[model samples]
Target: MASVDLGKVLDKAWADKPLAEVLAAPVSALKGVSDRDGELLDEAFGVKTVADLADLKYVRWAQALAALDAAK
Candidate 1:
């Protein structure tokens, strides 16, 4: 299993949470993402939780594009 240092990616309040809880946390639970940013994402794309952001079609497309670019 791959171990991740959650403190590096999540906000302090979320760092100690379980994976499922973290995934269900609001986007603001991520490091450097403000509550306002979470609100904007919610308003724009119906993205409420980290899982919602990860599952977004636009995010998947962008990730694929970035991977293709990196492979070039």
Candidate 2:
């Protein structure tokens, strides 16, 4: 899978968006996520947005990577 830049995914425009609103957005909103990968995230893991991706219980690796990538 390509590396996703979470900062880009959760752009400044979304700084004040509600968690639920962020979670409801399509995975495609995430940088470096292809349409297919987005589908897989939703189908395989029910990951649909930045909030979902931040969930450590299901997507630990993603959570870690997001932290690192977003920090940059």
Candidate 3:
């Protein structure tokens, strides 16, 4: 499985965008997200981007994993 490159997903170009705007992007923009997982994320949690995946109120595991990944 490919790893999610959060740096690319959360690129400098996205820095000025609102959180909602950032999260509105397609999940495919996230490095490791397969089409199937992206669909599941959207269907199950409404997650469409890195920000959405990192939302603590929704997918806590994603947030935790993101943190762990960042630490590496």
lDDT of 1 at 12: 94
| Clash totals in order | 0, 0, 0
TM-score of each: 0.92, 0.47, 0.44
Give residue 54's lDDT in candidate 2 (0 to 100): 67
Candidate 3 displacement at residue 1 in angstroms = 27
Candidate 1 lDDT (Cα, 0 to 1): 0.97
lDDT of 3 at 71: 100
Candidate 1 C-alpha lDDT tens digits along 13-60: 999999999999999999999999999999999999999999999999
Ranking by lDDT: 1, 3, 2
Question: For this target, which candidate reaches the highest lDDT against the unseen true structure?
Answer: 1
Q: Which segments of model 3 are wrong by more than 4 Å?
A: 1-23, 56-72
